[model samples]
Target: MPLSDDALDQLFREARTHSAWLPKPVDDALLRQLFSLAAMGPTSANSSPGRFVFVKSAEAKAQLKPALSPGNVEKTMAAPVTVIVGMDMAFYDYLPKLFPHTDARSWFVGNDDLIRATAQRNSSLQGAYLIMAARSLGLDAGPMSGFDAAKVDETFFAGTTIKSNFLINLGYGDHAKLHARNPRLSFDEAARIA
Candidate 1:
């Protein structure tokens, strides 16, 4: 069944990319819950490539600071948590467990290009799922692609097969600080029917 109007509004219409935050903290359990909800979203062949790093500690946040563009730094630092959404290149290794009906892992084992493409595409979808999951849980999100991905990968995913895709600052938003909601393209302008 489709969600009710209120649920839809909370997840889309009323949802904004929050730039200012309330002076509140996001609990670890809530973060875990957000991940659990997001993980349920689908991906091709069940290749769950998204990996998240919740940068909540001051030290970790500091490590992340240098990679942020000037515009993203202040709001990112002020938020309760900044989630580094990354794509795991070796995600196919878990296919035996995630998509266990057959030998799915063998499909990508020797195909670097296919693995890279699938990982990037599915992880981006998973990041979108994370945004919706956060909204459903009454948290605001600011998804940003302004940061230096290579720097973020070096700082956060070094020695791992993960590559940073984007960042999301998560917290209770201060509605008063939001700019007016901008106009969106109408369906006719944004979509096409074959």
Candidate 2:
């Protein structure tokens, strides 16, 4: 069955990209649940390359600070959690477990171009899933790309095969600080029938 109108409003129409957040903290359990929800989104060959880093501690935020562009710094730091969504370049290595049938891994093995493109695209889709998951859980999200990816990888992923994709701030938003919602393209203007 389709979701109710109220559910659609909660997940889409009424939801906004929030920058100013309430001082309320997000629970660890909720974050874990959020990931489980997001993980259900599909990826090619079940590559599921998205790796997230939840930066909440003062030290972690400080380490993330210099990487953020000037405009993104304050809001990101003030939020309860900042997720560094990274793509695991070696995601194909797990196809044996994730796909579990035939030789799905062979499709990407030794093909650096395919690996990079697929990892980037699927991880971004996962990041969008993360945003929806946050909203579904009564949290607001501010997904952004205004940061230095290399710096973020250095500070957060270090020795891992993961490479930073984007950042998303999550928490209870201070709606009082919200600006008027921006306009979006109407379906007729943005899409075409074949």
Candidate 3:
């Protein structure tokens, strides 16, 4: 059966990108649950390249501060948890476990162009899944790509194959601080039947 309208509202229709948060902290268990839900989403060759870094500690948040753009600094720093959605470039190494039925790893090994494109694209899909998972779990998300990615990488993923894709601030949002909803493109303007 399809999900109810209330579920649709919770996941999409009524969800908003939150910039202001309540004073409560998000539990680590909830973060783990969110990732578990997001990981179930489909990826090419089942190569789930998404790697996440939950910057929840004061020290981690401080480390992330310099990388954020001026406009993002205040809201991000104030957030309970800021997730660094990342792509693991060496993700094909896990194809044996993720796609055991076929030799999928061979498809990407030594293919730099394919690796970069696939990793970036699939990780972005995983990140969107994460946002939806957060909303489903009664949390708010503010996903952004406005930060200095290189700095975030150097600070958080040095000597690792994982590269930051985007940031998502997660928490209970203060709806009173939100602005009016903006417009979106209509189906006619964005879609076509082939």
Candidate 4:
């Protein structure tokens, strides 16, 4: 069954990109649940490539600070958690386990361009799923791409094949601090049904 209008609004129309967060912390269990829900989202060839690092500790936040742009530093530090959404270049290695019914790994094993494109595209889709899942579970998300990807990868994903794609600050948002909602482009201006 389709969700009700209120449910749809809560997940989309009323969902704002939060900048300021409440003082409350997001629990580990909620983070786990968030990932569990996000993982169910579909990916091409079932080549699930998204990897996440939830930065919550003060030390970890300090490590990530150097990579953040000035405007993003304060809000990110204040956030209860900052999720590093990444793409694993070696994602196809697990295709045997994730897409076990077919010889899917062979399709990407020797193709760098295909591997890169698939990882980036699917991981991006997974990140969006993460945002929606968080919202559905009563949390706010602020997805940002304003960091130094190289520094983030070095600091968070060293000795690994994962590359940072973006960052998302997660927590209970302080709605009082929100700016007025901006106008969005209508379907006529932004899309078409060819």
Candidate 5:
């Protein structure tokens, strides 16, 4: 559906991170469309570092079970899908074309520190893009930081440079279960002009 101004406001302005979900499944085609939109969002050096692992099956969610905090386990497992947002530490390897006219790829290859930093920064940006993308596609999101990073790495990223950034549960949410919208800081409270 085309997003009207009111629709855009409804998607972001009033959106909540839903902890409870309806049983409706997010179809594969819609998931693909969501990603197709999200991947086009910008990243530094065009180093698209984000790699998503969509955990939909019972078997996959089982693998993710040990990584969750006790409080997060049931809600996450009950969702239709839990996305594993990851960052490729070697994301800059493709920067020859991604950020051409400079040796940006060389900038990260030698410095483990720089590579890690850029991967994390860019991947986090991608995760935000994922949230907006999901909202635009009419899916409710529950992004969570309550998980064991080490266990997630062991279960999902073993033998790879990809590291888990966070997890986001995706599905049709039950509006009846939503909490009242929480307060947000105003611009004066959050930002300052130098």
Candidate 6:
């Protein structure tokens, strides 16, 4: 369902990082809609490198359990779904079409360092887009990085060059789980004009 302006503001500005979730599942249809919306967000040269793996079932969730920090384990396990946000290291393979004007593929080829940096940076941006997209769709987000990356890679990305960048718990969040909103720096404190 498309949100109203008030709903959008509440979802984006007032939404909290919920550690607990109600027992509500995130269906594939919803995920499809989320990706459809989030994919429209810009990426450098249209690299669109983000990849998502929705861990929903017991078996799949088990693969992620060991990677989570103890503090995050219970909440993540309780959430209806957790999404592994990853990036394809070979994102440039599609660049001929994604950035047709230049030799974009050549920009990444043989440059492991460049590929790594670009994939991580772009994919993280896409992850943020995913969070906003979920909120727009009336879902809550708990973007987390408190996990063992190596363990996640072993369990989820085995046999693939995709690397796990972050995880997000998805569901109807329990508002009681939220902490108070923290303060933000003022414009003068955070920005500067040239």
Q: Tens digits of per-residue lDDT for model 2 on 1-194?
A: 99999889989999999999999999999999999999999998889999999999999999999999999999999999999999999999899999998798999989999999999999999999999999999999999999999999888888989999999999999999999999999999999999
- Cα error of candidate 3 at position 176, Å: 0.4
Ranking by lDDT: 4, 3, 1, 2, 6, 5
Those runs of model 4 whose alpha carbons end farther than 4 Å from true positions after fitting are none
Q: TM-score for each prediction? A: 0.97, 0.98, 0.99, 0.98, 0.94, 0.93
Query: lDDT for model 3, on a 0 to 1 scale?
Result: 0.97
Q: Give candidate 2's error at residue 171 in angstroms.
A: 0.1
Mind giving the per-residue lDDT tens digits that candidate 5 earns over 1-194? 77688786857887889999999998998889989998999998899999999999999999999989999999999899999999998888778878888998877878989888888998998988988899888999999999998899899899998999999999989899998988999999999999
lDDT of 2 at 58: 94
User: Model 4, 1-194: lDDT tens per residue?
Assistant: 99999999999999999999999999999999999999999999889999999999999999999999999999999999999999999999999999999999999988999999999999999999999999999999999989999999999999999999999999999999999999999999999999
lDDT of 6: 0.91
Model 5: what TM-score? 0.94
65-126, model 3: which lDDT tens digit per residue?
A: 99999999999998999999999999999999999999999999999999999999999999
Worst 10 residues of 6 by lDDT: 8-17
The local lDDT score (0 to 100) that residue 83 gets in candidate 1 is: 96
lDDT of each: 0.96, 0.95, 0.97, 0.97, 0.90, 0.91
Model 4's alpha-carbon lDDT is 0.97
The sequence of per-residue lDDT tens digits that candidate 6 reaches over residues 1-194 is 88687986766668888888998888899999998998989999899889899899999999899999999999899999899999999999989998999998998899999899899999999999998889888889899999999899899989988999999999999987678888889999999999
Candidate 2 ranges beyond 4 A from true positions:
none
Give candidate 5's whole-model lDDT: 0.90
Task: At residue 61, give the lDDT of candidate 2.
Answer: 95
Model 2 clash pairs are: none
Best by lDDT: 4
Better model by lDDT: candidate 4 vs candidate 5: 4
